[model samples]
Target: MKILVCIKQVPDMESRFRPNGEKTWYDESDLAFRMNEYDEYAVEQAVQLKEQLGGEPEITVLSIGPERTVEAIKKALAMGGDRAVHIRDDRYYQKDPWQIASMIASYAKGEGFDLIFTGMQSQDRGSAQVGVIVAELLGVSCATTLVGFSYDGGTITVKRELEGGIKGVAKLKLPALVTCQLGLNTPRYPTLPNIMKAKKKEIASLTAAELTGEAELTATAAIYPPAKKGGGLVLEGEIGAQVDRLMGILKEKTAVLR
Candidate 1:
């Protein structure tokens, strides 16, 4: 069983982020990058699947980003993917969901992959939409919020997380797309030995412009995330008065104050 895992490199959320001078993008100078948090879980799922399948199932890690993204791929390799492919292009810095999905789908077609995996969302953007869009472009079935799975021959059973503590069990044929959720499995840390091994693994580089003749990416305007709101309000007053004022505030916020 061959599996392809789409990973993403993102600015580490732990770093202090500042907006660009025009407030159009993040300040890159002081930022540290890492594998997108959700994608790390996706990588973990792929590794676990390979371990259970009793053979390393040709797990290829894919990413679209700048040259620095190689670091992210190396992390996945240190965790145990068979190989890594990076789509290098400056446009990836400005790629929207549609562009990213189209590019990935174009590359995956005819790759003869049995399964495709992605993290549920990228932490920096948190749009949570690309995996489905890519699956659509690839003309394959996709399931998201996956928590667990069981494979039987060519049939794959997956556990999907739903609303209010509900979970749905689904079965899909081979060559399906899965967006992994946290709690699927624990991601492994790279030991010093594996880190050394990763340094010797070859990372293949491909350019987005050369990737199977997909449509040129649409231009997008850069926009940084809105500044986070400050800490919550702390109400203080006599108990009864506090309750009444809290009710009034809540009502006003909910537009039920009338």
Candidate 2:
């Protein structure tokens, strides 16, 4: 089986964020980068599937980002991916979901991959559209936000998380795509040996233009932090006095109270 896992490099969620000068996106300087947390589950699931299938599967991890993205790809390889493909694009933040999916679909068109795995959403964008768009472009069956997965060589059965804590079951034949959700599986930490081995693995690099000529369909208007709110007011005194003061303040400030 040929399986492809898509991943992304995102700023560590714990890191402090600041807007860039242009205010189009967050500033990258001084921010630590890591693999999107959701993608870690996707990678782990792919490795587990490969083991279940007796390691016959050829797992390829792919990421689209600036040169620094290679670190994310290497991590996936260390976790058991056979090889990787890096779609170099320094201006990746400017590309919309359609353009991103187009590049992936274009490269995977004739690759004869039987399955594709991706995180339910990226940490940075959180759009959750790229995987489905890629499936649509490739004309393959797709299931998103999968919490459970099972395969019998030809067909895959997955349990998807829906709104309101509900779960939906889906079955898809070969040549399908699925976006993995958190708790689908626990990701394994790459051991020292595996990390060393990953350093020697091949990572094929390609420019985004080489894969697709699709133009951007959307543009960022602006990105900035939320406005700060006024400090909270504390009412002190007896319960009766506090209630009276609170009512007075509410009536003065809000028409609904009046």
Candidate 3:
């Protein structure tokens, strides 16, 4: 069996972010980069599937970004991916969902991968379209936001998370795609030996132009943080007084009471 896991390098959420000169995305110069948090669950699920199948599958971790993405790929390798492919794109942040998905689908086409795994969405962009778009472009079945997964070498069964704490079950044959969600599995920390071994693993590099000629379907006019709002009003006194004050404020400030 063959499995392809797609991942991305994103700025650590804790780091301070500033808009770039173009104001299209966050500046990368002073930011610390790490693998997208959601992709870690995808990688863990892939590794667990390999173990469940007696370690016969070839797991290839793929990422599209600038050279800094090599670090994220290495981390996936340490977590049990056999090899990696890096699709280099210096202006990756500028690409819209269509362009990004096109590049991934272009490379994945005819690759004979039995399964493809990706995160439900990226942390930075949070546009949860790439995996499903890749599946559509490849003409395969797809399921998103998977919380549970099982495979029997011929078909895969997954439990998808729906709104309102509901789960929808789905089954897909070979050559399918799935986008993993959080709590699907516990990600393991890479040990020292595995980290060392990952440094020697093979990583094939390619350029975005080499993969696809798709043009951007959307453009960002601007990006900025939300405007600050005033502090909340505190109600002080007994329960009845607090309720009366709340009702008075609502009637005065909003149309809800009317």
RMSD to truth, every model: 5.8, 5.8, 5.5
Candidate 1, residues 1-37, lDDT tens digits: the string is 8899999989878888777775556777878888888
**Candidate 3 local lDDT, 1-258, one digit each (tens):** 989999999999998888899899998898999999999999999999999989999999999999999999999999999999999999988899999999998898978888999999999899999999999999989999999999985999999999999999988998899999999999999999999999999999999989888888899999888776876987888999999999999999999896
Candidate 3 TM-score, C-alpha based: 0.89
| lDDT score, candidate 1 | 0.84
Cα lDDT, all candidates: 0.84, 0.94, 0.94
Rank the candidate models, highest TM-score first.
3, 2, 1
Q: What TM value does model 1 have?
A: 0.82
Give the per-residue Cα lDDT of candidate 3 at 148. 96
Cα lDDT tens digits for candidate 2, 116-196: 999999998899999999999999999999999999959999999999989999899989999999999999999999999
1 or 3, which is superior by TM-score? 3
What are the models' TM-scores?
0.82, 0.88, 0.89
- Candidate 3, residue 27: CA error in Å? 1.0
